[model samples]
Target: MSKALQEDSKARVKVLGSLLHTADISNPMKPWDICAYLADRCLEEFFAQGDQEKELGIPVQMLNDREKVNRCTSQVGFIEFVITPLAEQMVIIFPTLSFLTRNLSLNVELWAELWKNSFDPPTEDYEKLMARVNKVVSRCRAAGPWEEEAPMRQSSAQSLLSGSESVVTEH
Candidate 1:
């Protein structure tokens, strides 16, 4: 059973990585749009891989563009239906998701502080970097279940300087 669960998790991670990479290449700076697209793809794959009527608890046919558009527009509705549930699942299957969120949140806050001191007329490179940062921050913030959890404590000052340090310490 544990092996099967591991295999299922591996499959989901592969699918998620594929979806994220596809969205990154195709939609570049639009995080929300990319997330919406991936969510749709996830729903499709989830249904295709399982007994939709029994396993999903929701009708696969109803997961159409119209419904997606409606849900995406309503932040409360989107969180309730998509982000909340996915975050819960991530805690079980992808502990890294929680770690990623914590790191990204810290990065976003750090970047915002840096920007305050470094504020100037935005260069093209700066704008692009900011866009990428924002995308990561938004995704992290939207990773629902981990949002309310206590922020992970940092043990070393070096961890504050390099985000990669946290990943190393975690292992």
Candidate 2:
């Protein structure tokens, strides 16, 4: 009788697995709009976790806590400590994958810029400024109804920086 094959445990297999895992978590390495979309999804998940933890009377984790978590700060921490380090090491391991680190670096700069200009409140009284920035970002990211059926196109970070939404036409 034939038996099922076991999973590969070779060194190369392990390295490839690690690279694949990094790629899965490398949304920040994508263009700015895609990163924003992914960040929105991540926040939704974190909020859900926080809600469940609160309902269960368990202590909420910082990232999962909607009230305590500042998205910009948390994202900076995540990219700097988590994504950048991993991508840098991955590039060393696989030189052809250096683009991963490059994109991560660019994204770090973008996030830092956004945080400094918009998300970072100057003082306790600056909450309104942050809210306004968030509203503008939300509006820019809003998708039209046809977006669901259309092939997604990646938008450059420059477009986001410029705060211009390009008109789309149905072909």
> lDDT of each model, Cα atoms only?
0.42, 0.58
Tens-place lDDT digits, model 1, residues 135-155: 555666665435453333332
Please write out the lDDT profile of model 2 over residues 1-171, one tens digit for every residue: 012213434666667787888979988767566776787688779889999999999999878888777666567667755776666556665666655555555455555555555544466534543454344333222311112211222235556456562211100
Estimate the TM-score for candidate 2.
0.65
**Number of clashes recorded per candidate:** 0, 0
> Lowest-lDDT window of 10 residues in candidate 2?
143-152
Shift of residue 77 alpha carbon in model 2, Å: 0.6
> What shift in Å separates residue 130 of candidate 2 from its native position after superposition?
19
Q: Per-candidate TM vs. native?
A: 0.29, 0.65
